[model samples]
Target: MTGRRIVSIWFPRFAMDRWRKAHADTDDGLPVALASEAAHGTVIDAVSEAARKAGAKAGQKVTDARAIYPDLVVEASDPGGDANALMRLCKWARRWSPWTALDGADGLLLDSQGTAHLFGGEAAMLADMNNRLRRLGFASRIAIAPTIGGAWALAHFGDRSGIIIDDDALDGALAPLPIESLRINADTALLLRRLGLKTIGDLIDIPALSLARRFRKTPDATTNPLRRLEQARGRIEEVAEPLVPQTVYRAAQRVAEPVLHVQILAPILADLADDLCKALEDGGRGLRRVRFEAFRVDGHIAALHAETAAPVRTPDHICRLFAERLETLDAGFGFDAFALTAIWHDAMPARQKGLAEDEAEGLALPHLIDRLSVRIGVGKVRRAVAYASHIPERSVVWRPALEEQPGVAAMQAPRRERPIRLFDRPEPITVIYGTPEGPPKRFRWRRKLHDVIKVEGPERIAPEWWRERSSVRLRDYYKIEDEDGRRFWIYRNGLIDDGRGGPPDWFLHGLFA
Candidate 1:
């Protein structure tokens, strides 16, 4: 009812992925067409606007497109590249308005009410957008209107110079547009055309009951043309497709000129960090990880990344963290602008911090640990406490040094008592002669044979049958002392003289103090 404002953005060659493939080395001024390769024949998926002007249409076979122009280049559709390009456009469009939604695969919709004044005015904004896109080698069509639907209709079918900007001329502008401008599926458009309703105005004038009666055969068929027309005006709530999966916590400052020197970049970087910290403070949140993206003039980007141990919002702390990473930035050619983004962050929970005078040695220990980790590598300086499980392989586990150590009972809950320095894997030994239940008087380990001097009891231990009952074994372990006062823990394999195999295999498992 009041002054309505909208912007429709079109990516003309967005669907013609074949043109993209054929012109991979060069994507400019090429006649390109995309086709769906199937059993019947390859049908045109999409064609460039230039190719369309030369007589190309969807559903036409590949042979048909080539028949029109022998030099026509063709390729299969790449849905992924199209999707990625759409997302990048969405991110770049954030410069225009914060609220921008993907119009479809090849277009975007912007609610341009009071926000159009930001780029001088709606006309100037549209001109600026078109100019920038042209400079970047992309041909785009932009349309502004009183409603999203009207803008879409005008952008796709109106005069190439731009269209429908007057406040009071919305209906007159949209009146002549065809029904296909509503962006319905191909089947719906064909059915509407068959019923002698080729334009939106024709569908709007049709009686709802009569139209419903005529198309009652198909469930997906439109029954109420008038009601659908009202919905087409974007009056109802429409879910927007977001470009990014999550909301980004970011702050950036566009430089007046491309900065080539590090001195020029330092203050900007510090200022951006300060601004981001303020934003985090406003939301009562803190940052754990942050990345700085340096967008160059040539479309190449360099990124500097940093992480923090605790939730930090102070500008000084954040700036210091980025200091080391900033050295990694490569200012090839020149960087035009810098943008700071925080990836993994969390809210600053209510916690206690000791007063400056009463604070103990907390900062010192953390600083020491960080330095050690940087020098020795993060994974090397970790706390590892291996446990004693009935299964030898499950005996030991490694815990991160940063994590709090659990109670002794939690660590001691293993079913078996294992030696502190147990070899990673047990080694088999050749014993001259030994009973299955007794210790070996002499054994060969690593080809060196030693005779046993003192012998202890034969404690029996059985394998857990629940894991594999068929392959279970009973072992008789002995604590024995050799001739040179060298003590060893040895275990006899299988049952005591069951005659299941030859003489039992002796395994010198571990060494004693």
Candidate 2:
């Protein structure tokens, strides 16, 4: 079978390169080395070509290297910065292939099966990539093979740096490489070396069963070697996990001149919104969250993000939301490019409009909520949702208005007389004329006296025995109205003398409009 083509790009001095670029302004034409802390002392992690010529090498102790060459420049290694720089390069590589991914901290893998033709075939693509990296101040060794594993091994171990198109020549090409190219453990490699099997060709003729039995003592001794062998020979599949794009729907444009005024950005954003909405419509999807980014000429990026209450695909609506956020974008030194992306989306198949006019009106509330949410903030608008608890306060939850509501099966049983407003914590009240087990007749709350003129009977609600122990108090709630027509939901905690605690306390829990 014809396997997929893979390209591996390895940056041998990735960390050192990034460090040098960060200090480019202060860099003198001297040898430099990056040191990482080891158990014994700081060890050289990477060395510049000049440093290597000056008798400095990786793995050498820093103090010894300094003694050898006192003028050698040393800086602490930054592994994280290297990884981030590699990822940024991966993103920039999307111009060549969408399936580019980081192989390790120092390398990248690009599945270029059908993409090489776009850049004038495999050889041209390799040259193009090498030239681009050179322009970016990165030195890369690139190799192309029919398999990911083969490409990776060739990039790091083989003498060749260009395309390896003849699959039949793989064994011959890989035979002369050291046994360490198979990615086996140091112990296994040492054992193989001792046996005079110092190359992949030395073991290929041996029976698989014999190899397994001979190396049974080593962890994954048989499987690891055999798997790498098969992978290198293209006998087994090598799957590439590509990086996930930040957005599903994205449109970006680079302008001939940088834009400084917010008014110029408005038109550009509107056009991007139109393009994004069209793409969403084609995909039968709608956006819930959208982001607009302005990449400034000075390397600063300004972004504006907005959320919608419902799935939306109209350019007009999207543009209006972005207009509200345009003021927040700082066009530092002017923006060179504009990008609009749909960060979050949902399926929104087209539907026929309702026959009744009220049906259309029903949608207005959600649309209004979306607009308001964009203007203020999503957290500022909330909607009540039924929760799965029997306790009054626990029975309902308040969530962001734009969030998808829970399904019916996930909600608690319908409540018969839930109050319009519930207090975060029940307020303590002083009851003057109420029986121990009955609703209060007169109460003083918040420095005001209330004479109960109308009263509803105790709706006894037991505590959730499954979740909490029986020692928890039960509540007998009463709906009472004051002489001034103010309504309150008061509950008596614990039975009058149930032995759970002191005499039950009267608390005002909720208010009804």
Candidate 3:
């Protein structure tokens, strides 16, 4: 086809086919029918091949059908169950084309505009599509044409199903089809037939003014044949929304047979990662998160997800993330199809690579964090976030790296120089103060004595008088460098002769980088 190509698929016995597929152990030759209650009586909603051969059909009363065939197996119809399964099937159809959606309750619509070449050609694409559906235990009638309406018409009423119609031949191919192929309801079809308009050709020849007067002018008038005719002729465009929105970065694989082990999926997973990453690189974007879906033949999907600490387009990094999640993955009845998509992404502008493996500027921090997250868990890796407090321990809290810590407005960095490393609990140290309320001259810690070469501060920190008892003591913090140039953060616990304590004691709290 020229501009755009579409594929329409219809399931003639959708409910019955799905039911039989689920119960493969049952006798295939037995007659089966799905019946639902109606105002008049219980009616057959769908029938299997055996049931149809026994003179049973949809819309026929259950009693009447049973009258013709005494051994017909009757089961309650499940419209809701069929619909939910169909939606999943629509998503699974993405393995063939990203642009896929439910055509109706028992069909699918796909845009084949740019995807045909990937499957060889339009014919090979249809063959692959048919083979996959058949393997999944579905019976389908599919057709490809330049427009949605044309494809739908040909799939349902053409001389042969699974035919591709070129744009140049769409009119000739659609002319001989019955008016009901336009997808109008029975009443509308009956109305057209009564007016001697029995074929699409007849309706096409009718004057536009006459066709307009015969139907309502409102957009809700789905019974309008004129619109369907225009759509089929490619004069009017019909929009088909995909089950999953399109993404620039995606890759998928379909196997001829279902795979049973997680180990067997490694190469396929790697290939998908490489394909997706290549797409991201070409698009000038990076993947922040990706969704992995494995479609099983029984219609159940097994899904897993992974994300990065920073935007990335590396295949090995992406593969490693998924590898961590594969051990516990349950491959129910195995999987026949697999797909990958970068659901969340960010702009990854090109940059020059540096030769240094150790980055002092912290350029490699994100990669390190990502690796740690994968090894332990995505949620276990955390960083220190400062909070609004004066107490050394209360000044910051540990939180997950990916999670955004709440309001830093009330929090501020310490204006004073602080050690990069801090102790959870202060250790007691022996100190000789030059005088009362003065900085230390020497200190003994871990059984080693160190002479002070320089002293910076007696930064005063008052006790929380509101929350503490009258005995709570204030603190005098000092920044001192020993003679060897090794710095230490030590504090005097109380004032000398203060009512709160007999004498101030010194403790080493932290170390400088």
- Best-matching candidate per TM-score: 3
In terms of lDDT, the best-performing candidate is: 3
Worst 10-residue lDDT window for candidate 2 reads: 405-414
Candidates, ranked, lDDT: 3, 2, 1
Model 3 over residues 47-164: C-alpha lDDT tens digits?
A: 9889999999999999999999989999999999999989988888887788888988999998888899999998999999898899988988999999988999999998876899
Winner of 2 and 3 under TM-score? 3
lDDT of 2: 0.80
lDDT of 3: 0.83
Give every collision pair in model 3. none
TM-score of each: 0.42, 0.47, 0.48
> lDDT of model 2 at residue 484?
91
> What overall lDDT goes with each candidate model?
0.68, 0.80, 0.83
Stretches off by above 4 angstroms in model 1 are 1-4, 15-31, 48-56, 67-70, 165-168, 207-224, 234-239, 242-513
Instruction: Give residue 432's lDDT in candidate 2 (0 to 100).
Output: 86
112-206, model 2: which lDDT tens digit per residue?
87898999988999999999998888888888877776787788887866756557777787777787877677877888889898988886755
